[model samples]
Target: MNTTHTSRHRGNDTGTGATTDRTNPPMTRRLSRLVPALCGLLLVLVGVTACGRTESSGATTTDATTTGSELSYEAVGACKDVFSRTDAPGAQIIVLWDSTASVADMPFPAALAEDLKTASLDDGTLSVIAVDGEAVAPRILAKDVALSTTGERDRPSVAKLAEVIPACVQSVYLNGLVPTAPGTDLHRAMTVAAEIAEPGATVWTVSDMMSTSGQLALSKAVLAEPADQAAETAAADAPVDLHRNVWKVSGMANAATPLLSASREWVRDFTRGLCRGWNASGCKSIELDPVNPVRTATGLPKDPVPPFPAVDAVTTATTCSFTLPDELLFDGGSAELRGDVDEVLNQPLALLDANAETTLRIVGHAASSGAYTAAELLALSKARVQAVRDRIVAAGIEKARVSSRGVGDTEPLAEDIDPSTGLQIPEIAAAERRVELIIEGAPCSR
Candidate 1:
């Protein structure tokens, strides 16, 4: 780190026959003042430069000023002791980072960087590698370097480690932000880590476990396979030699297409097989994390469209019902479906599609406001139900699988009369006016 220096010159006249006044300070006093200033400067240099060098470990320290980013103080405080107190401090550690767009919301890189602070060993090595579409050289952040057991060497050693580890992590994170890598190559990355690992070493892989373009490329078909079968397929794609080293998979995020529970189980089983296969002792640790919501669209209303209430489906063991308000599906006194009803109807359509044997029933109800005669109300309700049924059939459900009915103003979802005065409640009456999709044989939970 560079420190700016400021100097001021005070001149004493050096003319011929000119003599110094008695008020002038003596040489010793001036030297004493200069000594403290020099000591202060030395302290600043030590703090910025990792005290120049370590005598015991011979570890090289990089200048922190050269790095573009540094780890936050809170992160350091929270993770300083994570790896330091482990039983085996002499184990070599290799970290494989997923440097792709998938890391937009991931925190594994920063977390690993912090934990590495206390995890270093005086005789062990620490390496960080970026996993991307193509292979790249691993960055050896620390070599045979550990925090000092004695107080004299501890501070500088920590300072040196703080710089290099975070610098490497920052590089990985920045790469993910503006990803040039086309796809994820998790299998190759793990292979590299395994090759460099010793018998007792630990290889850490931080990824979403979704390989889009590689020998181990993933698809819906792969995810649909049974756990063990999927594992066998992954192993055949890229065989790895773990050398009996431990493999730890962390932050396996969800893919957008598959459901969360399915994706989580598939990844967990797949990784377990990869670690247990290829001469590895066992899968040491694995963590499955939900992909951050920010990385995916929420389907929330934007500025141009006015915000409305969200639609939801109610389900039982053998039935699912989605209630669409009459106003949302059909305008006042009209049986024709509205143009904007597709988005609202998709919620129920998804539930029906999930179960192939499910059957759909569209039932329509009308409010009894005395605006039409009983015959007219029944006709209107039947017409509305038919319109809704047509849309469901058009969405690909077989005509035989769908049925329609209308109750007119006979079946009310809420009380239409006020018991005290026998007067009608407008809000309650409105609540009864809706079209309900009753799905039979649909899965209760999805």
Candidate 2:
């Protein structure tokens, strides 16, 4: 069996999408015959018997809580520790099962969703959105009420979610393996999830990510036109603001095979990097611990600072300086890059012109709030740098002069207290997502 999963934002201008596909020999060639039985058991265990009333009224409209204090380096580090533990706060996990024929018996999506629900979020909330392969749109599986001011769990919302999830699962089963589309519209589903989610929510999606259609859908969602025109038409429409965080779980061999083990590992790595000041581009920033006023007054040595690796790398002999804009580099406790990165890169590229001697080196960095393991950080850093490199090359930079590198969490730019925000800051991790231009030889006149 083969499965593909794709995720993206929809209904907003935040153009982001991810896709993955895996191929492997069937561990259960014989088990292929047992898919029906296994799938039946899965439905019995996780299916929904009822659909809750649509939450159309009195959904609490509370402002997302923002810690006024800058994310201190210490705080970032602490966040990393919390994210990596099994006891960490639970995250809202959304599973979109392809009802397509290729993955009719795959229990992997359900199993992974269950594991994520059970994963600890400490004081965090968990929600689920499950879609049937046969359905034209995704269906809500589960959700909890907004984390309340008093720290009490909203049992009503949780109960509602629990009730709906099984029904949604059953819906998938009843639909019975319609031919899986070449791709699922994961982007649309994710956009729906983002709109429904509270501000600052974390999202995890599990799927094989095999569909080209799904990928295209995600891309379209990310680049969708801003809703300003529609909002203006509504007299009472306040400007719509959108923000969402997404982590993708890929590398599963087939849609039917359970790969929760691998998916969990990826999620763990992704979250750690996110909370530790990894930027929206999936690059880490140099984070600094907040200067303790008392410690400074008492002349104590600051908290033991972790050694960061030097981020400078030689890419095709171009010694380029890599840096990130202070604002877009890192946001509090998240790895998704903020701002239009293509616009940001344009600034530096403009400086280079089309000089023949100018060689560009795009270096990606992953900062740590102390959450990401070395391997995870490295992957995030490399991907971000390469993304920028790809953009630069596409924008017309010479391929020969352009190269990319990932410097995993090894450099610092400022005190971790985000200069923009007064709170204790994460380490200066954003500087790592930088592009450098080396003027090799001299400018070549066109």
Candidate 3:
């Protein structure tokens, strides 16, 4: 009931805006004023402007206008531009899983969705499709309106933009019930996605890369061209990158066991390879590396680094306890989560689900340091704790099972020091804003 949420505020180096204190009322009020201004300014600077007129060309356009509804025309336009430049026009992501696999066993869809949501684009469109069966024809399980520059960031919009794994549908198909009458045809599925794409679009096939009877068929279809018309077709679509954005997702088999010991390395390698391939293949991939200081030295416009989300460390009993590296936390007095938090929390959540009977309790703590009274610190700490709790629950945990407690300035995980300067050691105050979770009971009966 009583929880302490301690957060620190740090200055933004690029001068976009001051970081808001997570718990301070005045700071919140101040941010309310500044946020609109900042957002407005950002909108103006990056606002979408018509580059060229898109007349109705003979190219078959899949009326993806419906899918763009989730993203603003401006954002969609930007994404389109990025993807187009990367030779990935009208992109599609496919998540394939074994027919016999359980919902919990398949995480590629969720991971793919998260990755797609965060993908940056200057002006192009992206869509995700999932398939599981021998049906030469792959039906669109879910299609979001094509996004552009100007659009609202609503739930439907976000969901449309995000690539959700079709666990529910997959479950149905795996039960010997084929969504398509011909059964799951991976080759045909890829072909359909490629055909529907704007001429010269990127097609990312995310599956276990395991094929049975359909493997050769799919490969031949992907590589095939009409002999007489192949030259003409290639000439017309010459600008389109021939290299398809086919990313195979494997290692679901590894998650079948409890420990996920074999899957861990596979996941890391697969994710890293996927990211690197997407980038190299010119697919407008999200940059995961730390922003290089040297880019600024070259007098290039500094890429706007988005603030990362804050993630609490979860201590699982069976696997190794994973805490986000300190570098992922907000610098001195900041409550904002860093981008690295995504990497830190994503894997843990998958691991937690893999191990049945693992229950988690989230505890929020606030470090009482600098400029605030004890009462103020307590209130702030509680707010911070609640923030973490909310995020966890949103990530699919049952709220009723997970409890939050605020311990104000009680236990210090590290020596109290100024996160920015590292010089001003303030006893043990820096550890206050931490949110800790303890795995308790058994993993919710899935």
Best model per lDDT: 1
Model 3 score (lDDT)? 0.36
Global lDDT of each candidate: 0.56, 0.37, 0.36
lDDT by residue (tens digit), candidate 3, 118-218? 43221133444545444344555423222222122232222322221122122222223223332234444544554445443445554332222243221
Tens digits of per-residue lDDT, candidate 2, 1-446, equal: 45543422322213344443322223123222222222232234445343222122322221111132122233232222222212112344434444432221333344444534343212333454543322346655444421111111343333323322332333322233333323354445554565665544555444433232332221222211112221122212211122424444432223332222222222233323332221222123212112112211122111111122122323333333434432333232334444445434554566456455676666565545445687887777776666666667777877887777776666544554455665433233334334344435333222
Give candidate 1's error at residue 136 in angstroms: 8.8
- TM-scores for all candidates: the values are 0.45, 0.26, 0.26
Q: Tally clashes: model 1.
A: 0
Badly placed stretches (over 4 Å) of model 1 are 1-90, 109-111, 121-123, 134-181, 254-259, 281-284, 296-346, 349-446
In Å, residue 2's CA in model 3 sits off its true spot by 86
lDDT of 1 by residue, 379-419 (tens): 89999999989998899888998999998988887777678
- Per TM-score, the best of the predicted structures is 1
Which residue runs does candidate 3 get wrong by more than 4 Å?
Answer: 1-340, 413-433, 441-446
Candidate 3 global TM-score: 0.26
RMSD of 3: 26.2
